[model samples]
Target: MYGRMNNNIYILLFCIVFLISIITFTTIRIITDKEREFKKLPNLKAWKYISILIIVAITSFYGVEIYKSATNYGGKLAWFIERLKNERSVKFEHNNIYEFGVEGIFEDINKEHPLPKKLYMASDFDLTFNSDGIITAFDTFVYGKNAHGKEETYLIAYDKKKSQDITIIRNGYANPDYDDDKLVEPLIKTVNAIPVKQTVSKWNESKYGLVYYGKRNWGYNTEGIININEDGKEHNLEKSTSEIIGYTVSIFVPGKEKEVVPARYNLIGDPNWSKANTNPNQKSSKEKQQDLTNSKEQFYLSKEVGYKLNITDKALGSTFYSLSKTIDGGKTWEVINNDPFNGTIGSASGITFLNDKLGFLVAVRPSGTEGELYRTDDGGISFKKVNYTPREVKLDSGQSISPFDSPGMPYEKDGVFNMLVGQGSDGDYNGNSSALYQSKDKGETWEYVKEVKSS
Candidate 1:
């Protein structure tokens, strides 16, 4: 029945077009013959009305042809015009992983960092934080096909302290029905840039914004960003779908979550993966991908592009894992540093940030038999110990994994373990899982406080 109906529609359209083509050709031939044959006068004397109809028909065909010709000409003209009119857009010269992670945006620090002019943050698939501090905005993944399904990822954020949901984008992990053995592709889908609820205590100042990275569906990373603003996310389990994946940054207007950017001006990042979590290796399974991570190296997200930069198995004996960045307002992104982690960090369950330029990323480095907290001073270029903090976080050897991993190993080591330095009413960052901190002389010393918090 369906096939017959489709065939009927095709036949009807074909007949109408065929008839039009034949009539137009025949009329042109008749007009040409008349003109050649001693001025037949187009049979005007016999029927002026007929001649008029012929004129209308001929003109209509000619009109369409002329319009098509003009359209093509205009397109050609446009191509040349653009070449002449626009100067090359300002080019952001590429830099290395160390260059990308440098601390240069700290010129604007003041005694009291005023209410943020703008803010944004992204987290992993399963959320760990309750949206505290500058971890400004996020949305809970509502299951049951409303937007996100069982393996769906939802991106939520706010410009300010309001309930407005500035959805960036969403994507599914993998299809259970396919049995592809593919663990979600590691691109934007793999690393959930979803911010943990906890933040760092005080000590330093620098540029600020969220760091979001993704893995899994590398091609459809743009679709994730699209999901942030629109309703009805993509569902592979069901049929019929539309989506685009990529990354962008937004200025959360004071007192509002409204995204205020010039239309079509999505400040997209390096055109590597579609979105951050787009898995480059869809053909491989989850276990195979994990098997590759056992070896270690130091990974860095430079503006660099090449086979060497894109895929890194290890760095410094530590697997260079995933990393995130918030260049635009929308989707979170993976640092081109796209390798495993340089060291073991997943055991340290929390993350915090001050800004884009300078922030502290804390993680657990297994010291002998136990895990110790390590701090990254400049994003991840190099890490150091917290001034007064202990060398390592000792854990019981009987436990198979570190403390944070006991919670189902939700977060990956490299990007997940982090901390921030901020001040509260009491003024001190006193090693609280979540709280405010104070530094008397610009990070040379510090203290922690539980009163007011710093995000």
Candidate 2:
């Protein structure tokens, strides 16, 4: 598809260049000819008329050609955009793992799409817990054969304990035999199961919106953003799905939970508000960088100074990771510096500030060599590299791994900082089985402690 588009662009460029060359040649000849020679030329009026006619003919021909080309190209582009903007209905031949861990199984069903007596495979498929580990909501991925035994995937939301269903999504894939209840058109936007971290954790409680993308579908292919609560309660956000493509969205913060920010890639209430178009086909590199700069931001509030820090991560490029300060609770932000963090961040990164002037930043090093750790004493204005012995530990599977391979959030208590670094047992090598290390002197020295298990 891209190759064809490139060919079209090449053709258009060639035609433009050819027209410009012809016009330039004609003008040069007209200007260079001597007045006597030019005037005395036989059939000069005929030549002038002929030239005008030829130019008009050629212009008209190319205009029509260009118009046809553009129309066809525009039609194809619009089709592609539409395909992207909507949920794609697909057929399932066998059991397959679709995007967002959505598994489709060709199975048997009765005359209606009734609740399964038992899940084909079970164990917390959709139940999301609260901070206290209590079930808050369950976004069930209901898949079964309909009246005709055609396989279909359905979505339904339920409150805690799965006692009451609140919403149902009818994707029109297979009309499930409804029992008196009118089947409202289900919003087919794919969503990953919202983890308890986003639902109940304090770090994510103050977010503005929700952003989710599947691993198989990179970028905006399988991404969704909405202003609905975890239980599918809509807040009138009315945002188009396309607008959430490149945004790193989160939920609304406390006291602002009811606020609905429009579709924007950056912070909603930012003083320097800029809506970035994340469409790869329509956006330039500079625009993408700006959008990324606004997407991944970390906020920290100091108890003593009452100051707030916002660290923006512009990853996957050479753009600097900026540090911004907000004196008044995120109403406005001023960029303090973008140079403090260099080669200290990767796609998966995190930042933590102990106070107004003390903070730690860690990121996976470029090319996955090791995790880089940085510390800021004077409120993130400047950072100094802190050295530690990267743990080389063995898991139960007898696989050798490095702690720096999978860096995680640092836990600090009584000036004793425990860096919970673990080597991922999974294929991705993310630190799943973690080990805790003590760094009493603020990341200067480290001592290995017992292995820590992720709760």
Residue 9 in model 2: lDDT? 93
In candidate 2, residue 321 scores what lDDT? 56
- Put down candidate 2 lDDT per residue, 335-389, tens digits, no spaces: 7766666644332255677777877766553223345567788888888876666
Stretches of candidate 1 exceeding 4 Å from the true structure? 1-326, 329-348, 365-380, 389-438, 441-444, 448-455
- Model 2 global lDDT (CA atoms, 0 to 1): 0.43
Clashes of each: 109, 4
Task: Give one digit per residue, the lDDT tens place, for model 1 in 1-455.
Answer: 22234636987789799889979986887777855644656654677787698889977975675455443123333333433432121111211111221111111111122112221111222111112222333222111132222232222222335432232223311111221121122222212221111111121222123332222222223321322222212222121132233343221222222333111112233344233323444434643433222111111222221111122221111122444443432233445333223445222323333333333333322111222233445554444544433212243554332121111011223333222332211222233223233454334344543333323
Tell me the whole-model lDDT of each prediction, alpha carbons only.
Answer: 0.29, 0.43
Q: Worst 10-residue stretch by lDDT in candidate 1? A: 101-110
User: Which of the numbered candidates is closest to the native, going by highest lDDT?
Assistant: 2
Give candidates' CA RMSD values in order.
28.6, 21.2
Error of 1 at 251 (Å): 32
User: Which whole-number lDDT from 0 to 100 does residue 12 have in model 2?
Assistant: 78
TM for every model, in the order presented, reads 0.22, 0.34
